[model samples]
Target: MPLCRLAGAGALTLLLLSSTVYAQSSTATGVSRAANPALSANVLYLVGKATRHDALDEPDERHAADADEHGAESPGARVQEFELRMTSFVDPHVKADLTLATHGVSETELEEAFVTTVGLPSNLALKAGKFLGSFGKHNPLHTHRYPFIERPMAHETLFGEEGLNEVGAEVSWLAPTDWYTEIVAGVYNGDNPALFSGEAEEDVAFLGRVRSLVDLNDATTFEVGASGLTGRHEELSARSNVVGADATLKWLPLEAQRHKALTLQIEYLRGDVGGATRHGGQVVARVRVTRRWWVQGSGDWLAGDDPTVRRVRGLIAYVPTEFQALRLQYGATFSGDEDTDHRVALQYNFTIGSHPAHAY
Candidate 1:
């Protein structure tokens, strides 16, 4: 059979399967979700194929060792995640939130469990528990909030594939500056896979971030931030330092604030691992063509001791409502002195209840 014909058949099958699953799940629990309080679930289904050496399925050898230690798997077509989320106000002074993620069929993990202060003096708030580090914008963003299906190569190389998260405590403050400014500092147990795997009481990682937003006009806005992390690499028994900067610009017409918008975002990260420095960057732009249609493109570059890898990606998404989305993405990656790979992915994301808002 022709490749195009085969691809078409596969696409049709996936669409049918996804629709059936969604309908059944909705019908089975519609009443329960409607009656429940502070509980919700989001399911992400992804299907894809790779042409030539599937780098995603066979990540760099260096990181493969680390993933093996934690039983992480390579990229593939599967139920990416079924996230059960719970949020509630514990009392007058505190709020609690937790996310439990089920990957594939058997792997279930506590993705995030944290509590935050409801009200604090001096424009300050405190957070404690296990959560993703606030080292950079990308590190803190969940998969569903990502513009692209895959994370930037910088995250894969500097931190583990899952970025960086640990049992930690954070203190954040809103500055009194004219522009919207905030600063955050966190200390973690340094138990991430490759970045920091030390569990000793004294072995810890410290990170800080400063972010500011400016409104250029009623329709335009710009935000920029800097972040840094210092940690111990127990595997290598060396000191690790990572520094990053990110910026985003957004525009929305006053008349079509709900339907049309444009966003440009970019981030750069540099890491020093035992004196060996590596750097990578990614830039993405998204344009909303209509109330339910959007297109996004991204470019990624990673260079260091290994062969430099570059990738270009484009995505088109349709959001029928606020709770569901369908997206298609195509990407091509090229590594110097290595075979280039092309891939395509289709994803469906749906929420079943009153989900909490994502962080800015």
Candidate 2:
């Protein structure tokens, strides 16, 4: 995305982000405004990826013919990629987000197109369109929020590349609390697994969390939550019911009883299910190595009988300013069947347009 988009969407994201320096100006007539409301809304995004599969580990019996995460089976295949996302808001509480990209980094087809945000009341916010699912907090967060460039494999596998979005409605609320606590739940059609994620069904889904980290006095704070989806598809359906839970702890070394500053952190996630049961947990560590440099590492262990999936990646990122970032990383996988492959990638991101402020 472009710098122009970042500045525009900054406000759209305001409710989702920790308070910023720009917040201000309340009227007795009953309305609030930013000291600087925002100029024009615009967006531009670009990304490319190149990967080599020296050996995609394939166990003796795990069908190589089955389309996997990459949707490929042949060896020595190299994958390249591209993406562009742009959105603009006409009103403070309403906006449109559109994403266009290739199926393996090429112009094979359109990737994502969705519209979001219509604030109704203290406990109601609505979204309707085809986009990424918000099952886990991480699924809906932007690329900028993450300490590393890539999301954990657990996320990639469960949500797929698009992060599990479909034609649906989502509702969120601010629960009464001394600290920040949020509840978000959604209902939609499962994609067509054979071609898409499946189709909509008779069932609905829910994801809820009790959080308090925003502006907390404690340098270290915590959160615990659960997310699950269960739907029954009629005849000839490939429905996979799921249920899960997650917990996080942020141990910021530097305390600022009064401010927002860089902090080192670690987090973990675990989930239990019937279809993809014992999907496992992950460990993440991140550090702001310098004013302009950041380092992060993450590891995962799959718990099911499946061996084709285990992953770890290390990353280094550069932040010239808050609006943009450049990153490089090394990703390795232990798919029980495919080779323990390795990958190298480059990513450049510019936050665009008025959208929302939730971080990854």
Candidate 3:
């Protein structure tokens, strides 16, 4: 059978199974008013000044022609985004989460709407619906949680603006042995514009990841992971494959101390598009300077058929409370022989209502 048909059948099966589980769990545990989904919302605002110069010797076009540079333009002030999130447990065996986002006054988008199994047998769990792919450390994070004003070069060029969000389902298992370890696999409707562009539901994508964590000591910790995704690239009528690895090291002064901490994170991604290959990654370090102040820096690099690009960024932030933060960032990028692009951005974020903990 065609891939689209297979995808459609799989989706229907999962939906029906989830419904049955939900009904059974609900009967096992009586529902209460608290069972109703909880609501929370956040908004992020950004103002920035930026200038881009093409390669000094290259022909000057009105705009730098790069497919990966799709994002809020420079040299302006705009409402970056507003997000509304809802979550709650459906029963003893399932929970649901939904996220909605609006940019400026544009049409609102359903960022995520997924149902996750809660009390599955063994250490297994399943999640299904419109959701983000578990392809990398960065793919599943919401924009408001981003430490930087914009996504890294590698994520943008490789996965597109939204970072692998699609209609999909994921199954994960906690390994029986060792320190924190998990294996996850997922299937998705191949709908991403940058890498996958299948028109029919039969078009499908597959992803897998293995993650592990170790506590080196009371004050330090380490984590590492690898991920892969493959699918039909409808745009080129070819296959696209992406593989990535990531690591993180962290230190804290004490178990209860949240103010004094340092963390370093790195990730590398490589993609095969048709017969060509492209690769890149980013390294970021963050330190808390004081109770309300923090500083961060990151470096990004991309190598491929297109001009190689490197970006460096420095940021300083004041987070008075968990509910609000103000940040100032400066970044510069050099692409091959092209003139360097510079940007200075100021961002503000605020939230209302109770927010849930993010995935680990």
Candidate 4:
């Protein structure tokens, strides 16, 4: 069959399955998520987010691997673009999501789109089409969901084959724990680190992640998680970054309306293969002064036990409301004889058409 015809059929198949599943779940639960036929048909949820990031200096590869051009004279010389994503429920039990995003790159290079539906049973979910591999907590979440405006020094090297989505199947499991525990595992096309789509990368990868949230008390809480991954590419065979763990503990003092939620979060990762060893740690602290106002700051430094590359980064964010925030970031790195360059970015985040998640 023609490729276009094939793609169309796949999309139709997912939509039909989603509709069938939603009806079954809603009828069983008798949950009134909608009031009328129209409302019921549109019982799906939608979320929209916007962000702006400015690289402060030349894009230098040494410090921020993703910032290969960091300190150039005109950091903003490239173009700016927009992204919009939609997710809706076809039935009470199934949700379909679509993402269409493009920016800066010439119009000729706009990214294609992908849609997938999730089924519920055994607390198991299946994903097809294109999306990101579930590596870290941050990988699956929209950037707006990040606590800081930007990722840490090591994010560039391992976030993606190049730095985006890919075709894959992902399965998720929610362990029946008092606290929330989630695990996501998947395999993808592993396309090279360039075009964000395709069918081959020579070999597939084995990826897995486990996350847990622990509530210590009414005023104290903690979260811990870890991930394991391995993959192969050309000259870079048997690449892996294993055993990364992170935890955040918070101590809250509540008196009158005046409140403080002081949290300390730390993450550690170590590994290397085929000339790439990624070991780094990050420390971050956040302080909330009001119900809707908060301040946060973090510093990160990373060095592969090899000691040939060292990176440093600083992050800050101010949230004025549940739906809006302002963020800033700066980073620098030392790589052998390479130039030490700096990067700076500013971003604004807001949800356009959806209700807040867990926090709300």
Judging by lDDT against the true structure, name the best candidate.
1
Backbone N/Cα/C clashes per model: 0, 34, 4, 16
Query: Per-residue lDDT for 287 in model 4?
Result: 74
Tens-digit per-residue lDDT, 151-233, candidate 3: 88788777876679989899999999878999999999989877875356578999999999899998888999999999998
What is the overall TM-score of model 1 with all chains considered together? 0.85
Query: Candidate 2 residues 321-353, lDDT tens each?
Result: 655667777778776665566776566665544
Q: Candidate 4: which stretches are off by over 4 Å?
A: 1-73, 76-81, 91-93, 105-119, 160-164, 192-202, 237-242, 250-260, 305-316, 328-345, 356-360
Instruction: Give the CA lDDT, 0 to 100, for residue 91 in model 4.
Output: 67
**Candidate 2 TM-score versus the reference:** 0.64
| lDDT value for model 1 | 0.84
All candidates in order of lDDT, best leading: 1, 3, 4, 2
| Model 1 ranges off by over 4 Å | 1-37, 57-77, 358-360
Considering every candidate listed, which one attains the maximal TM-score? Answer: 1
Residue lDDT tens for model 4, 1-360: 699999999999999988877776666667665642221101111121212222222122333443443221234433233345555665675555655543333232223334444657687776766775565544455445556644555554444323435666778888887888899887766663422122444667666788888778777778888877655544444454445678878777546223567878887765454555667666777777666566766666556644445555555556666556656666565656756656666666555555534541
Candidate 1 vs candidate 3, TM-score winner:
1
Q: What stretches of model 3 exceed 4 Å from their correct place?
A: 1-35, 53-71, 358-360
